[model samples]
Each structure stands twice: as C-alpha cells, then as structure tokens.
Target: MNRPQYILLPVSPIFIAISLIAAFLLNLMPWGQFIAAPDFVALVLVFWGVHQPRRVGIGTAFCLGLLMDVHDATLLGENALAYTLLSYCAIMMHRRVLWFRISTQAMHVLPLLLLAQAVQLLVRFIVSGKFPGWFYFVESFVSALLWPLITVLLLAPQRRAVDKDHTRPI
Candidate 1:
C-alpha cells in the first residue's frame, strides 16, 4: 500500500532553538541517575543533525556536548567528543535515512546512539578507570526507542495544513 506524503513547511530557527533548550532542560531534571532515562539532548542533536545538517552541524553538537559535560561535571570534552561524532554520523547518513518512514529512522539511529554512548563510556573509563557497567548503555537504547515520539512532536510545528494552496510554495 502506498501512503501519500505530505509536504513540510520550512522550520523556524527559533523553534529549533527552543526544542534544543527544552531537551537540555529535560536532561537537567532529577532523572540523571536513573538507568532507564534517555539522553534527551543527544536525541535532539541527532534529529536536527539529520534534518537540518546545515543549520545544526558538528559545531552545534559540540557546543551542546560541552554544556552537558559541565552540567554532569565529567571530564571536559567527553560529551563534546561523543556528540561531535554523532552529528557526523547523522549527517553522513541523512540522505539515506530520509527515504524511510519515522519508525525505520529509529532503527537507523540505534547504532549511532550506541556508538555515541560507547565513546562516552570509553572516555570515562580512560579518565577515571571505572566502567559504570551495562546499565550505562541503557540511555542510548531508551533514546533510540523514543525517537519516533520525538520525531512526531518536533515535526508537528512544521507540518503543513491538509488543505493545499496553489499560490504557496511548499
């Protein structure tokens, strides 16, 4: 069965910024110690990196990662390194990922999320000589699982109305 594709409106920079801030705030909540809590900032970074590579590239990811590092009080550049690589991987696969539905996009994102988490883990181990164990990876899995929900919520503002206007360009 073929599904009709709806054209999306151009996304606003302000909305993108707000979403990033909201994701950061979500991460800042008291759930940081919970093993099952997803990394909201990482998910949003991947989403934007894939959807608007030019607007949200490695630099943006790195900056956000640094903020996360400071917030977590971990070694500087731990998150920055992980997020920079995550943005790179997302940007590299953006073209292919766009062809799939949102559900499939989550599958595509899982490995990247895993890899980002691995990088962070490795950095932490190298610095502190400690491994947080398997539970450390739960965040990536949870983040991947939340991808579809995040996609819908973030894209809602950019979706055009059902009615079409001929004079307007999509």
Candidate 2:
C-alpha cells in the first residue's frame, strides 16, 4: 500500500531555534571525541537549510559554525566556513532532494556532509599541517546514515495537522 502524502504545516521559528540549540548542546557532550561521533550541528543545519531555506540560511549556519569554532577552540571561522558552504549547497539542492525518498535523500546528503568535513580537514591541514587520518571522514558517513532519523524527528512538528481530526476514535 502507498503512504499518503503529507501536507506539511508551516514550521515555527521557535522550533527551529530550539532544534539548533539542542544540536549544539548535543555536540557539547564529551563523547564528541569519538571518531564516529556525528556532528549534530551540521546535521541539523543541513536539515533546516533544505527544509526551510528562508527561515534558516547561510547566516544562521555561519553563526552556529562560529559558536562551534569557539566551543571547539580551533581557528576562528573553521566551522563557520564549512557550515556556510554546506548551507548554500543544501539550499541549492533542496528542490531536487525533496523529490526523493528518505534513503535516497540521505545518499545525496552524504557528499555534502563529506564536503563540509573536507573543508574543515583542509583548514586544519593548512593551519596546523596535520592529517587526522582516514577515520576522520567516518563521522560524515555516520551522519549520512542518520539523515533519515533526523529528518523524521526535526520534521515532526510540521507534520502535525493544524487542527486535530476528531471525526473518529483517538
């Protein structure tokens, strides 16, 4: 059986802010040291960049990236540049991406995530002359794997009908 297409409600600005803050908070956890630990901020930024381009665009991504750069104590603008680029790419491809299934969308997003990671990696290399190893790219792969779950979760609020359907049982 085919699933019904949802007519999504308008997303709330407050919800967007909360989600972005929550993602940043998640990154603040100590587990971020793990090579496989996904970048929560990047994931959420990409989501909003695609779903609500006008509401969350390059400036939001840049600001969040700066916050991450400060929090990570790396060179200023490292995460900012990466996130800004990711946001731009997401906005460019949003219409094409919205046409695909969740899994396919994740596939499309993997490269963008990797590109962002590559940007960070390149900046690190230029500034410190260090290669973080092949494992450094694993986080983007993991984030891509998580795209479906994140999409479902972040889009939940907008998925609800404006008014409850009380015609039938609860």
Candidate 3:
C-alpha cells in the first residue's frame, strides 16, 4: 500500500493572531436585527484551540471572550466564561477530533457549540432575568453548519505540499 506523505509546515504566531483579529472583526460586523450573526470569534477560537492548543488555549479564549463581551455590549465576563469552557473542551478533545474527517468532526463539535451557547444563555438570563427566546440559540446551529467550511479554510494555510520528486543523498 502506497501512502501519501505531507511536509510539516511551520506555523507562525502572527498568522494565528491575524486570524483571531479577523474573526473578531467579522463578529463585529452589523448584520441588522433580523439575522443573528454567528459568533465567528468563538468559532475561530475553537478551531485554533483544537489545532494549536499550545498557541491558543484558555488564556487566549478568555481574552477573546472579554473582547467579544465589549464588542457586543453584553454583561462583562459572560462570554469569557463561555469561551473559557469551550476552549478547555476543545483542548481536551483535540487529539480525538483530529482523527476524524472534517464532516465527521462536526458531530463532535455540535455539542460543544451548543454548550457554549447554553453557557452564554445561562449567563445572560442570570444577569438580565430574561431569556432571549428560541431564536437566540439559532446561531449555535449556524456555527455548527459552518464548521466544515471553517476547518477547510483555516487548515488551508497549514497544509504542506507533498513533493513528488525525491532527490536526497542517501
């Protein structure tokens, strides 16, 4: 059996920072009242948490969550709590998640996404004493739906090209 091998590409810290920043910007975009924009920053955080736990972990998630909290004008630390838990879950499951195909990985991610939303909802309820209704949970499904796409786009830069010609001194 012939197996294809891939070169290991070097990951730069700057690239990860830029991706997080972009995600934050995306989350900040105005989408009107009708459409509840998905939490792009949280999604990106999970992606990096699973792929590069060492580079992006609990601290990073907490910081991003705080920024998101400020961006959305929500109760402070609400997103931080959710994001911290989400990142911890992702880090713990990173090894297992990497074994599955991107499509299959969504199944693993669905619960986590839901958990993050649930935490956020719980926090909101505690602070405001009101629920945002069923529609508020819609973004969790939307985030899960985009998981495969996120995996593909984020991993694109990290995929090392397989060299066909082997020219090495033996």
* Highest-scoring model, lDDT: 2
Q: How big is the positional error of residue 137 in model 1, measured in Å on the Cα after superposition?
A: 0.9
lDDT of 3 by residue, 1-170 (tens): 24344454766799899999999988888882658668888899889988899999999999999998998799999999999999999999999998777777888887888899999999888888998789887887888889999987887776754554558421
lDDT of 3: 0.86
Q: How accurate is candidate 2 locally (lDDT)?
A: 0.93
**TM-score winner, 2 or 3:** 2
Q: Which whole-number lDDT from 0 to 100 does residue 157 have in model 1?
A: 83
Q: What lDDT tens digits, residue by residue, belong to model 1 across residues 4-113?
A: 67678888999999999999999999876655899898999999989999899999899999999999999999999999999999999999998999889999999999
Which segments of model 1 are wrong by more than 4 Å? 162-170
lDDT accuracy of residue 94 in candidate 2: 94
Q: Which 10 successive residues of model 2 have the least lDDT summed?
A: 161-170
Structural similarity to truth (TM-score) of each candidate? 0.92, 0.95, 0.89
Residue 141, candidate 3: Cα error in Å is: 1.0
Q: Candidate 2's residue-wise lDDT over 41-148, tens digit each?
A: 999998998899999999999999999999999999999999999999999999999988999999999999999999999999999998989989999999999999
Candidate 3 lDDT for residue 115: 94
Error of 3 at 54 (Å): 0.6
